[model samples]
Each structure stands twice: as structure tokens, then as C-alpha cells.
Target: MAAKATEKTNKRDFLNHLETYLSKRDGVDKLLKISRYATKIIIASSLIPETTGSLIPRLKSFESSVGVSRKAFRLGKFVQDINALRASRWESNHELVLLLIAYGGEGFYYFVEQFIWLTKSGLIDAKHSKLLQRISAWAELIGYVGSVSLKIRDLRKLKDEENCVASTIEISVSRGMAYEEEDEKMKKIKEKKTLKGLSIFQDLADGLMTIADIRDGKGMLSAPNVISSAGLFSAIVSTHKNWISC
Candidate 1:
């Protein structure tokens, strides 16, 4: 009976968390991204046999619409980066370098994406879309590189801290002292390490997609299915992060 009650509580808590996650703008955007990439994967993959020619076009259209809608949803998102940059002005030089590259590059990418969205929406000349997309792709690539670098550096520091905390815990245990505080600290560090690792993975996946975009889908990593898979992976990681925060 207790086990069943615990299971019921867990389910209710999960539902509440999901409700909160889906309520936020970022959560909705990530969900849309997941849907968009999943649709792209279906359109690109052979899961839908050649005999089902009719579904391909429709799926492609849906993917395209979702892509445009995502951009629309992200309209003015560069403002967030602007705010981030402002808040980080007092950080260390090394931190500032990464922050500038990551936030500035992504900010510009988002800015240019607005133009691409306009072009796709027929509000602007189609001739300029390619150039804007190329610029956005490059900016995104740079941002991802900076983000991955920053996360790796942070992970290394976290590892060092974890080691120190472990040694302290060992000493405390040997001396028969209470180490609950150290244990709690270790848990927090491990959680941070996990999140940072996820961030790096997400950034790498996104970087692959950006590279594929810049290369016009002609290289080894530029296969349609590969791009879609990377996009979906990135989206899922981001959604997971957002969900946990929610």
C-alpha cells in the first residue's frame, strides 16, 4: 500500500512538473524544436517507404512551417543575450572572452535569423535568404564553439573541486567527524558536472547542425538524416535542462 502511494505521488509530481515546463516560453520553443526535427527526420529517413510519396511532401511542408514558426517565436531573443552580456561585464577576462563569443555570436545569429524568417515569410526578397542563413550559421557555429569551451573549462574546475571535497570527506570520516556538509557540497558539484556535461553535448550536437548548414549539406556530417538527428538530440538535451529548472 505504501509503495503504491509513493508511486502515485511520483506520478502526480511528474505531471505537475511537466505542466510547469510546458508553460514557459523556452519550454514551448524547445518542444517545437523537437517536433520540427522529428518531422525532418521522418521526411529525410526511409522509414516512410518510397511508395509513400504523398506523405513526404506534406511532412516537408510541416517541417518548413515549424522552422519558420520557431524563428518567429524567437523574435527579439537577442535581447536576452544583450541582458546576459550586460550582467557579465564584471566577470574575469577569461570568462568575458567566452561570454562575448558565446553571447555576442548567438545574439548576432538570432538577429540575422529574423531576416531569414522575413525572407521565408515572403516579407523580403528571396535572393537575400541564402546570405542571411550563411551568416546565421557561422555565428551559431562560433557561439557553440565558445559555449563548449566554456563548459569544458567549468567541468574541469568542478572535477578538481569534487576531488578536494572527496579528500575532505575521507579525512572527516577517518577522524570520526561529521561530513554531512561536505557530502551535500559533493552532491551539488556532481549535479553541476552533470548539467555541464549535458550542455557540452547539446552544444556539440548543435555545432554539427550549424556546420552542416554552412557546408550546404555537402560534407560527411551534412546528410539530411544526420542533421535532423543532431537537431533532435540538441533539442532533447535543452528540453531536459529546461524541464529540470522548471
Candidate 2:
């Protein structure tokens, strides 16, 4: 009876958490991102037998629809970077520069993406679509580059901090003093490092997709399967990160 009750409690807690996660804008966006990339992967992969003539086209249509919806969700999202840039002005010079490049690039991408979305929706000239998409891809590439560089620097600092904390933990343990606090601090640092590493990987994956776009999918890296796989990996990593935070 006790075990059954505990299981029920855990299930209820999970459902509540899931509800909370789905309630946020970012949460919904991440889910849609996952859906969009997963659809792409299916369309690129051979897992589905082509005997079903209409399946691939339907999947492509779904992916495209999800893509447009994701853009709509991101409408006005560039304001976040504006605020981030504002807050970053007082940071270290290196950080400030990277933040400027990263946020500026992302902001411009999102700003231009609005028009691209409009063009796709027939609200703007269809002739402008290709140019706008190219510009957006380039901006996204720049933003990811800056973001990855900044994260690498941050990871290095975290590594140093982790080493310092580990040394303190060793000394405390040898002296037979309480080391619980140091141990906890080390755990937190490790968690942060892990998250940062995941973020870097996600950024790199997204950057690869952007490169594929900028190159018109001509190179080896731009292969449909490779691009879809990278996009799906990025979506899963981001979704995991967002889910945990929720």
C-alpha cells in the first residue's frame, strides 16, 4: 500500500511539472523545434518505405508548417537580446565584445526573420524571400560563432574554479574537518560545466545547419541526412536543458 501510494505521488508530481513546462513560451517553442527537426529527420532518412507515395510530402509539409510556426513564436524575441546587450555593457571587455557580436547578430537575425516569415506568408514580396533567408542564415551563423566562443571561455574559467574547489575539499577532508559545503560547491560547479558543454554542442550543431543553409546544401556537411541529424540533436539537447530548468 505504501509503495503504491508513493508511485502515485511521483506520477502526479511528474504530470504537474510537465504542465508547468508546457505553459511557458520557451517550452512550447522547444517542443515545436523538436517536432520540426524530427520531421526533417524522417524525411531525410530511409526508415520509412517510400511505397507510401504521399507520406514524404506530408511530412515535408508538416515540417515547413512547424518551421513557420516557430518563427511566429519568435516574433519580438529579439528584444530579449536587446536587454541582454544592455546588461552586458558592464561586463569584462572580452565578454562585452562577444556579447555584442552574439546578441547583435541574433537580434538582427530575428528582426529579419519577421520579414522572411511575412514573405513566406505572402504578406511581403515573394522576391525578397531568398535574400532575407540568406541574410538570416548569415546572421545566425555569426551569432552561434560568438556564442560558442564565449561559452568556451566560460568553461575554462569554470574548470579553474572547479579545480580550486576540489583542492579545498581534499585539504578539508585530510584535516578531518567538515567538507560537505565544499563538496556541494563542487557538485554545483560540475553541473554548471555540464550544462555549458551541452550548450556549446547545441550551438555547434545549429551552426552546422546554418552553414548548410548559407552554402545552399552543396557540401558534404550540407547533406540532407547530416543537416537533419544535427538539427535534431540540437533540438533534443535544448529540450532537455529547458525541461530540467522547468
Candidate 3:
């Protein structure tokens, strides 16, 4: 009983330490920076000519309707505005709160573009289609960046797995080669193990490629319409939530 209690205490302490580490302002900033870069890379790889042609024209139409210049649309003004509010004292910003409400709308746009791609490609089933649409609507309404943070966690996990698989492949290959001169039977066993490891590495590489493709599609979809909506929503909700509770 004493041992079990000690183990539980240790686990709680470890979790507390982890939460503290992750919650620090610097840690959050670093995570955000990493996510942004990952998203950029994904966008670059997924933007095929056909996808670009279809999406860009629609994005332009949306921009024109909103009366935001093409340059402002591209520059993510909403994100900038929310970021400014984040730095300011939360007590005095009602406009920022309204912006947060609209931020959710922007996030909806991003999800819509993603859903369109998935639906057209037949990657997502019809059953989940409506659910995704609803989630997108809520995201647009909420605009808190929490959903994006969950996605960032997924991306980071995928990246870490890819690295681990690569390392395993390298280690297996090195061992196989090192033991090649010992005996024919041993060499065959080592070679087989190495080949299996290589196959796993290749599969991981393909999965990473797919992630990159998804990221690209998302970034391109983030025109001012979606981005602004999300930014405004995030600002309002975060500020208001903080204010009411404080």
C-alpha cells in the first residue's frame, strides 16, 4: 500500500512538472512557432496546380466581397489584431471581444476548404461530413486557437514518429552491415530485419508526405475571410472569458 501511494505521488508530480513546463509563455510561443512553420510546409507541398486554380479564384471573390484588399487578405490582419489585444490589458477592449466572435467564422472557412477537398477526393465518409461542417461552424464561432493547438499536437507527434522510424531503420541497417561477414545464415537474418525496418521507414515517409499535403491545403484556405473570422472570435472570447472570471 505504501509503495502504491508513493508511485501515485510520483506520477502526479511528474504530470505537474510537465504541465508547468508546457504552460510557460516561452514554451507556448515556441510551440506556436513550430506549428506555423509546419503549417507553411504542409501548404507548400499540397497546393497542386489544379487545387490552386480552383481555390484561388474563389478566395479572390470572397476578398472582393469583403472589401479587404488582396494584400490585407494575404497578410492575416485578424491574427495580428488579436495578437495586439493579447498584449494589452484585457479590461478595456470590447471591440476585441467582438473580433473574437468573428474569429470563429474565419476558422469555419478554413475547415470548409479542408472538408471540400476531403469530400471531393472521397477521403472523408459521408457520415462524418455533416459533423465536420458543424465543427467548422463552431470553430468559426469560437475562434480560440484551442482546436488549432490540438492539430499542432498531432503534427508534432507525427514528426516525432517519423524521426523515430528513420532512426530505427538506420540502426538496423548499420547492424546488418556490421554482421555481414560473420556467417551466411546470420547475414540473411540481419538482412531480413534491415529490410523490414526500411519498409517501415518508407511507410512513415509516405504518411509525413500526406500530412504536408493537408497542411498546404489548409494554409491556402486561410484567406482573410476565414482568418479574420477566427481571429476576431478568439480575441473576444479570450478577453471576455478572462474579464468575467477575473
Candidate 4:
């Protein structure tokens, strides 16, 4: 089980950590290794008799046991409960990945082995309704997209810098000073609050010429900013539609 959150930290701690993690060399290496191992597993499973069906269908019950049961666990009561679940820590992505693969991986493989056994012994009844399965997948896809927007908002909280949202508006008004072009107001107007490199799916290119236009004093908001923003937005929508199509 994962641990519960006793204290909620600022959203910056989470989003920044994910950004840093995905950017690191060691973190990428681990994900690559995990991918390689997964690929090998799938390839090996292909050698299994076709009558056994897809390995994924066999893993459904395993997901219920190993993935969903963390709801019952409390923080600190179990060494690893729901709270133990975290995205990569910004400082130690490699170490964090190792810990999850160590603790979480054990439960994952154990249940998968159990699934194989039950299938072999004819003790398992595969009873997932096709419509229910489709709905579940659809709901999960919706939740996944919502989570992307949620994290984007979490990153937006990062612009607050002082954790001032829960407190008074005075915190923001008090520390204000600069009126320079580099000020927060300018950044917000440019819509580049957080790091521009947050996601690879978005880039300053494509309509990157607009950035030059702003520099040349053409207009603050021009065709390229609108075009690039619309492109990125549509990328997300297209991805969702393509996923559902498959």
C-alpha cells in the first residue's frame, strides 16, 4: 500500500519535481529500462499458446488487487500506504524510481503470478463485461486528461511563489516593487509564467517567429502566439480523440 498525505505541500513541490524528474538523464534511463523489460515480457508472452488470450486480460484482476486496494490503508500505519505514492522527487528521481520499483514492483509481480496460477488452475472466472470495460477505459482516459490540466494548474500555483493563495491577498500586494519588463505582470501577459520547457508536446517553435515579432515591437499579442497556443491546445484534443479511436 501507499501512504496517505498527513500534510499537503504546495503544488509546486509536485509539478516542479515531475518536470525535473522527466528531464534528468538517470530518470530517463530507468524509464527506458522499464520499457525494455516490459517489451521483452510482451514478446515472450507472445510465445504462449494463443488459447491463453492476451496477457493484458489476465492482468485485470491483478490491477484490482495491487493497484486499487491502497484506499483502505492509512498514512504511517503501514510502512507503505497510499501516501507513499509520489511522482519523482526533483532532487532524486533515480532513487525515487528505484524505491517504487522495489516496493511497488513486488506487489505487482506477486499478483501477476497469482493471476497466472488461477488461470492455469481454472479457478479464475474472467467476467469483465465488454461494455463495462469500455466505459471504464473511457472514464480513465477522461480522468487522465483532467489530471494533466490539474497538474498544469498546480504548476500555475507555482507562480504564486509565496503560498499566498490560502492566506491573505496582502502577501502579494506587500512584496510588489519592480515595474520592469521582466516583472511577473509581463510574464503573465506573455503567458509564459512557468518554465516554457514544461512539456515537450509544446514548443516555442512552429509559430516561434511571433516571439521575434514581440521583440521587434510589432504587437504584444500577435498571430503566432494565438496560432501556437491554439496548436498546443488542439494537440491535447487530438491526442484524446486518437486514443479513443484506437
Candidate 3 lDDT, 1-246, residue by residue in tens:
999999877664655555764665334333433343333333434453436456545544443333222112223334543554456443335544544443444544454546644653467776776666555444443443333333344455555655565566567687775433334444444544544344333333323332333354265444433443333333333333332222
lDDT of 4 at 13: 67
Could you give candidate 2's per-residue lDDT for residues 65-175 as a string of tens digits? 999888887789999989988877435787878888899999999999999889988899999999999999999999998899989988999999999999998999889
Writing each residue's lDDT as its tens digit, candidate 1 over 128-232 gives 999999999999999887778888988999999999999999999999999999999999999999989988989999999888888888987899888999999
Better of 2 and 3 by TM-score: 2
Residue pairs in clash, model 2 = none
Q: TM-score for all predictions?
A: 0.90, 0.92, 0.22, 0.24
Task: Write one digit per residue (lDDT tens) for candidate 4, span 1-246.
Answer: 123343444224656665676574334333433343333344334554446576654543443443223222211222332244453343366544544543353333333434443543446554533333334333333333433443454466555642343233344346674334335444453344333223323322222322433244246444433443433443343333332222
* Residue 220, candidate 1: C-alpha displacement in angstroms: 1.3
Candidate 1 colliding pairs, count: 0
Candidate 3 TM-score to native: 0.22
Best by TM-score: 2
lDDT of each: 0.89, 0.90, 0.43, 0.39
Which of 2 and 3 is the better model by lDDT?
Answer: 2
Give candidates' CA RMSD values in order. Answer: 2.7, 2.8, 20.9, 19.8
Worst 10 residues of 1 by lDDT: 45-54
lDDT (Cα) of model 2? 0.90
Candidate 2 residue spans exceeding 4 A from truth = 1-12, 89-91
Superposition TM-score, candidate 4 onto the true structure: 0.24
Whichever of 2 and 4 has more lDDT, that candidate is 2
Candidate 1: C-alpha RMSD to true structure equals 2.7
